[model samples]
Target: MTVRVDQFPEVQGVVSEPPVQARNLSVGEVLGQVTELVQAKKYDEVQALLQNAMGQHPNNGDLINANGYVLTAMKRQSDALRWYRDALEFSPMGSGIWNNLGTAFKHLKFYNVAIACHQRAIALSNNEAFLHHNLGLCYAEVGQHGEAIMAFDRALALQSDFHLARWDRARSYLHLGNYRKGWADYEVRLVSGQIPARSVSGRQWTGTPYAGSRLLVLAEQGFGDTLWALRYLPRVKGLGGELIVECQPALCSLVASLGVADRVVAKGEPLPEADYYCSFCSLPGLFTPDLSLLPAQPYLSKPAEREAKFEPYLRKGAGCLKVGIVWSGSVTFERNAERAISLERLLQSVDFPGVQLYSLQKGSPEQELQGVELRRPIIDLAPELKDFADTAAVVANLDLVIMTDSAVAHLAGGLGVPVWILLGHSAHWLWLLDRADSPWYPSARLFRPRIEGDWDHVLDNLAIELMKLATVKVPLSSVG
Candidate 1:
């Protein structure tokens, strides 16, 4: 649901004046001093100064706008909206006041009204780049990629070096599968001349490999992205380079066997003497000319004893099908709380008439199950298992794996295991709109939200499909 508030316009702002005026001052000029304080990020003094100026002239629009900006900065968004409205009520023609209101609304997630307010601000003041950028963000949120691109273009036209607009436009292009523009925009990650200011004194290596140089590629993001992007390391090695890879402790040995790199080290357990380095993600631009050239090869673990290890885990139960489930991902991730489904909710959705469910989830306090045969309590396989190789052994044994977008999903896909990936509304660009298949993982099927940000409806639909698959008749020989 979208909220409603005023839109802020981009402004070719006038340089703010000093807070203390020397000339004989009117109430309006005194209020401007308070505004100058707000502009300079001196919020603590704004209240007293504004009150003193208001005592002289009780209802000034500029003061109200300045006060509203202070409230917005403090995260009092709803309160800030009220002040902006009051400012507008006092002086309807004030373009800056209207622009401030629009920004408050945009912050509150009121996309449609934010668009209208920004447009109103633009009408009042025709040449503001910020207003265009704000409007573009709202348009992109509502799936108007074409309009969003045009708005970003207008913002850039006004200010040629606007980094924020460039970044947003690149993301919009990526969401629409316009990879050339997306990767081009993504290059800013390297060239911006600002890597994280972490202590890289001993660890960091610039990309200047010499003969027999051992280049180290470090995994920097979440598990799924690290696993998925690791597929490209072979190409990086093929560029006549020696390689060492640093990965999360859990994934170190699993990655080492992929045959792409010479050595693999775990996190926090350092140096193997490498001459150059890059992030796991940045390899894309170096390896593939475009998204079309994405090799899509499966580089993963398939233990020689995979079948033997799994055989003991599965007992001959009454269920016709044995399904494995993963309901959560890394809790520290930004959208993890939203994307993660409750174990209760997941169990409720899947029909278990003739199916046995096994938990394939990672992390602490693994799954809990009730009402099932061969139940020796819900086995918390995560602690006992080590890395993706162990996870692969279990998945290879299961008839199917149903999971959310997590590291397990990537592992399953990489192992050439067929899976149903349950996705949230407004998912990552890779999922796209209303499609059951992905170019990234041909072995996977996508089950996405029917409406924006709605998971219950999506899960209900998934449950229906799971029931059908469980009950479908097949020969006994085919079960193996």
Candidate 2:
């Protein structure tokens, strides 16, 4: 077969052209074009070109590599793996090809194989910080925190300015209950990087002496995270500083009750004048040790109306024990579906004689209270809940709160109330591994799932504990 080459008269160059009725270009040329197309996010073109190239050069390493990348982009991970392996056979020196294989394996939950491939990539190209970071991610996913931290450390050693490795190392440390290190690493979120979606830009933070300075601290992330991190506010206040806390609208009124801040405003509202700014979540990182010496009791300002209206509903009978139940957690969270149990399961297992079950649950769980033996029939207090303070008022009235790891749990723990938190097998980083109590929340008790995605066992254990509480007889003064 004769290949026709076209000569450019003006440029004085010869370019490869489809010879009269020719099929296509060489495999390398096709792969090169496909690489460009994929980089440009032209997935359809990349797929078409790769498919055509594969027809001619099915065993070509470059073509297979391009095909693997395209398949990965299309999320056809399994198909991508076969191509990546085939490409590896031809170009064993290519670290990128190995890394792509590792990524595909990682997505498929093949952790062991992914780790091997990533390690091979690292051995091939030790200078590539991304490969080390990617390996760190895979290690973390597979519950190998030590290795993950080491990989992150390697990545940091290679590039000191890499914020992502810093974040990953801190997260791994936090997961392992290395709070001293975790909190220190968590400071990376405050500086320049991927800013969260908020309009709090242009606010300056002057870490100058707090004498007569007003600091505006904005809330970030989930409800529970904000509530848990707000414990350091008293320290900030003790520094002769006034604070303006801007939080979610729902939290403003409740947070105001804490009395730590001079002013509490909902996010996106008008801001008060301040000499410094910080995020509410960064509190623990800045408020150094002696955490045990620090008070864990609730600091929320009690709302007058909430205390009046909800107190009567929590009337404790002479013989009956009052317990607040929260079986299901928020579905919006990724791990919630696995962690939260069905209300039916809770109702079936809970056996507490002379125990009055009340619903302190707000929002979505309000509908599930139908036909249940709730003391006050679950009420929708979402509208009335001005902040965590109102919720705290309700929790303060209850003898104990049994809840999934949600905002309520944090609120209860922050209030110095006894709270049993039901956690998923792969629970949040704060829970740590194999322990009942949380250092962050002294009053919080963690009950983790024995098996992955198993909540039935957790409920059974909770029911047994509740039954024990029901039979116990304690003096009136000792109850609180």
Candidate 3:
């Protein structure tokens, strides 16, 4: 997935304010104070100060632009756009105002407008590295990987130490399946301050032999990321070291059951003594740089006892297919809006004969199902699911899973369960591009939208596939 560039706070440099005159300060001096407030994260105070200053100097371009910047920081992109336009009216030739406007447009997902604004900024000041970087992000969002890469290349040419540009370029490279450059450039995650470096005692592992040593694998990023990277733990163990995995509390029980880590510790808990450590996602770059040596087998399984607890929910009519469905992920995720579809939309589009659809969706998005009519009954099992393990146990009882991009998809894939993932045109980087099969999950199949944001096309395609799957007679032994 393309990371949103506007999500990062603009880095500010220390600027000495010019000496105040006998009367009121100039627009530049007032804007300097606004910049300081922004840097301090006093967004409300910045807005208030900007409003009062803009009242005093209504025609000042700098004050208008500063007001727009504050609105953008407050996540009022539409309001920010209006202020930015006002600033342009006062000083149409200012490159900085155009660049800031482009950032606001980018946040609002107006890629074409953002591109135009950034291009205008470049036209005004062609040598500015940030203009190219911002332009690159707009291209990436629109799935123009080649142009995004070129824009980032130009950015780095102007400023070699631009780590954010490097990190974003890495995503575009990975999205295009250039794994070698992608993973190598992915190290910029740390340098760019996207993923903080852990402050453990031991030196970071560099794929060197760690025979008879203890290695601590630190889990980074989201739950799905950790789950996806867990498949590499056995390979870490094969490097001849005892492994201790540090992960989020929700995943402790699940990761412990994988049998690759010698011990699993939840984050914020006391760590066991280890000789070396590495982030979980970093293992792929070290062990599978070519992306060719993937262990496409089930690395996770629901315990027999846990599976037994959920067995009662698997009951269906004779010869009926049991399917689990997750239409949303965590609402707080950056791309959750793009990744999740409404349950009503999904239900309206697909029809599965002789199939029982179980609701595997969780979080606020589950409310979409409330008062919605369905052609077939859907059992809501989300309340019963205590954790990822509980979800896995329930999934173990189902014949197949249909989901949007979520942790459940990764869970089902990791368990070797038959899963069909519905994807947008710009899917996650791991799923790659233009392929139905995944190297990470041999049993997983992908169904992507024909056009961006056209879920109707994707759902229509899925309905056809579901009909084909429904015709297959699954052996009773496969169902819990």
Query: Which run of 10 residues does model 2 get worst, by summed lDDT?
Result: 4-13
The residue-by-residue lDDT of candidate 1 on 46-70, one tens digit each, is 7666666666666777667767876
Residue pairs clashing in model 2 are 254-387, 254-389, 257-300, 257-301, 258-301
User: Where is model 1 poorest over a 10-residue stretch in terms of lDDT?
Assistant: 1-10
lDDT of each: 0.70, 0.71, 0.80
User: Best-fitting candidate, measured by lDDT?
Assistant: 3
Model 2 over residues 215-333: C-alpha lDDT tens digits? 88888878887887777778777777677888888777777776778888888788775677888777766664334554546654446667986755655433566667776666776
What ranking emerges by lDDT with the best candidate at the front?
A: 3, 2, 1
Off by over 4 Å in 2: 1-53, 60-94, 104-110, 197-208, 311-321, 327-341, 344-387, 454-457, 471-480
Q: Name the Cα RMSD for model 1.
A: 6.5
Across 365-410, the per-residue lDDT of candidate 3 in tens digits comes to: 7777677666566778888887888888888778899989988888
The numbered model that scores best in TM-score is 3
Which of candidates 2 and 3 reaches a greater TM-score?
A: 3
lDDT of 2 at 411: 82
